[model samples]
Target: MGENINFNIVLFEPEIPQNTGNIGRTCVLTNCKLHLIKPLGFSLDEKQVRRAGLDYWKDVDVEIHESFEELRKKYKDGVFYFCTTKGKKYHTDVKYNRGDFLVFGKESAGLPDEVRNSDPDRCIRVPMINTTDRSLNLSNTVAIIAYEALRQVEFPNMK
Candidate 1:
């Protein structure tokens, strides 16, 4: 990647502040960019976010986006992977490229059908025991997939 960013983590209307805070810490450590779509459930300000131990929030490369379309327009060539429980492929099945976009949905409702269904081939999921159980926590899910991508890319600038 030309920039310092090794990858992109796009959250489509994330709800919990703690989850976002945790994900932001991961982004800072991984040199990934975090793009938050509008209609976020909690504040990004340090006070509430610190509940998740995001003391280095300012070091995170975060961008507030008005819409997914706007983000696509900005990063026109970015390869996007939609992560959903409804995905057709396991996350590890796909090869991750540096600077690719890993798109996740909100805590309650996942990516709107339109977005997830838009590209079936690009949709992915983490292996789970049962579909009935509540899916993994948002931050955990992000960490699992993000680290897998980092591993595929040899952890980029991370030691």
Candidate 2:
């Protein structure tokens, strides 16, 4: 059998329940694990999450981390790729593989300086219009990058 592709979608202090829920649904659809850091603006168990994700919540594999350090301790071998508009490298340029973790920050502030600068070598960004000053919606951005990573890993015979 082909090796299982262990993909993880990490949200650092996510701020919106709907966006998180949508990301959760995407994780379920793509067979990727979802990891969320604490201090979320909206409750993960909120009705918004349930409403947005609908029945997809049951299929999604989700892990809640109290802190990045907590998660880092558990997943050492995985590549941590932080997504940011300020990143010098494009997401497409990364040679994504199994056990790669794609991390996104909060909607309002993006990744904190310490976190964004934690591993500059692993930061990735999506190309966007120069005329526009803002990034894509959190859910949309996550779906785009996660699917690309999934595609690169051969989508791994997902069920």
Top lDDT model: 1
lDDT of 2 at 102: 91
Candidate 2 on 107-143: residue-level lDDT in tens?
A: 9989988888989999899999884469999999999
Candidate 1, superposed: residue stretches over 4 Å from native? none
Q: What is the TM-score of each candidate against the true structure?
A: 0.94, 0.93
- Deviation from truth (RMSD, Å), model 2: 2.3
lDDT of candidate model 1 versus the reference: 0.88
Segments of candidate 2 deviating more than 4 angstroms: 1-5, 131-133
**Model 1, span 1-159: residue lDDT tens:** 426678899999999888898898988888888899999987777476766745668788889999988988988877999999999899999999888999999999989998897789999999998867589998899899999999998987678
List the pairs of residues colliding in candidate 2.
none
Q: What is the lDDT of candidate 2?
A: 0.86
